[model samples]
Target: MPDARDKAPLLGLGLVWQQLAVGQRFRSFGRTVTEHDLMGFVALTGMQEPLFVDATHTGALGPRPVPGALTHALIEGLLLRGMVHGTGLALLETHIRPLAPVRVGDTIHAEVEVTAIRPTSTGGRAVVACAVRVRNQRDEAVMDYDVTRLLRGESTP
Candidate 1:
């Protein structure tokens, strides 16, 4: 349990972070899918199929078949970048599903919730668990999952 004075202050501004409780929902930004995003993936894993590259192939089916990585990126990368504050920690887990083909201009966002936050029993740190709903611009539920991240208190230095 954190002491009354153990609240971690926000970086720069010195405002105390409101250690979020369960069921806290946060709105995350949505952006149009772009080529640059996939280039990195190709560079890392090598573009192997036209389904992920050739729009013609994607259009053959209907919409562009968005890379699964994009769905994971939105849910894991930018989604909760701002949701958790005062926790000097990194991501521990993430899972997502691509419900439909997403095109180059398709936009998507995350609906997030803070499911749990508690002190790390052995390390004197905090662990936060959350559930995320990744939705497309059409307001369709494309994916959902739970995640956990570690946090540290101000006392850590």
Candidate 2:
């Protein structure tokens, strides 16, 4: 007979190959340098700096800068919902950075690769790891993050 300790759920792992393999190219939401998205960021942060929302200030920069945090959120959104929503886990870890400016008229796309997956220590959940990125039309990485998620299993009725 199985002991109560031995009745715990078994852990499993899953893998996702290079998203580049899914398609040589992926589409991203379109935006512009002069768009509200940039201004909204400055406003939300309560930043009165002219460089963020002021066109004159941003114009000198060649374009407005998209917050690295927002860019990271975009990358995470693409992976958590757009690409692997069905993975059935909540995010566990996120390490992100923005390397370049994300301006208006730039289309944003993502790249995803599964690194690892397994059950949680409690035996009631699972975990997934993914490499996620959001890039502009030029294919230069504007945002990058490594994400981990917790997967939950079914309960018997």
Candidate 3:
């Protein structure tokens, strides 16, 4: 029989601050945007703009254009599930830019590249900056953003 030390862990854990290096790149699993997602987001957030809530609001973009904020949130959720679940301390800053319209039923994923890493003066924590590009199933760049987050170090402070 195998002992606990010889058994492999089943759950995936987030990376600590020291494990990340500048210029390191990571890819997140894809998530598909469905009509239910749009509806729930619109109702929950009260974003009742015609572009999101109106089914017949047709414009130059498309008939079913979802909000850029929703896309960003979905990407962040993906990252939280895949990369930074427990080791991430807090979200310090985020700068977002929408490049293209994302409609319902489009599967999206994020490509993240670490831009910088700086250790804090007090605790054994570090701030990590990443440049993220969101792409749809068709391989089109739909959004771009830069996010800064605080992550815990390997040892307790």
lDDT preference between candidates 1 and 3, better one: 3
* lDDT to native, each model: 0.66, 0.58, 0.92
Sort by lDDT, top down from the best: 3, 1, 2
Question: For model 2, what is the C-alpha lDDT against the true structure?
Answer: 0.58
Per-residue lDDT tens digits for candidate 3, residues 1-157, read: 8788766754777888898999999999999999999999999999998888888898889889899999999999999887778889999999999999999999999999999999999789999999999999999999999999998888833
Q: In what order do the candidates fall by TM-score, top score first?
A: 3, 1, 2
Model 3 bad stretches (over 4 Å): 1-10
Count of backbone collisions in candidate 3 = 0
On residues 20-78, what C-alpha lDDT tens digit does candidate 1 reach at each position? 67787887888767777765575677865777666566346465556777667655666
Q: What is the lDDT of residue 5 in candidate 2?
A: 80
Question: Candidate 1 has which clashing residue pairs, if any?
Answer: none
Candidate 2 lDDT, 1-157, residue by residue in tens: 7789877844432222222232233333433334676667667878656666665663544666656665665555554444445545456787876667776567777766656656566756657676767778787887776777775544301
All candidates: TM-score: 0.75, 0.65, 0.91
TM-score (C-alpha, index-matched) for candidate 2: 0.65
Ten contiguous residues with the weakest lDDT in model 1: 9-18
Q: Give candidate 2 regions above 4 Å deviation.
A: 1-34, 58-61, 84-89, 154-157
- Every model's Cα RMSD, please? 5.8, 8.8, 2.9
Better of 2 and 3 by TM-score: 3
Best by the lDDT measure = 3
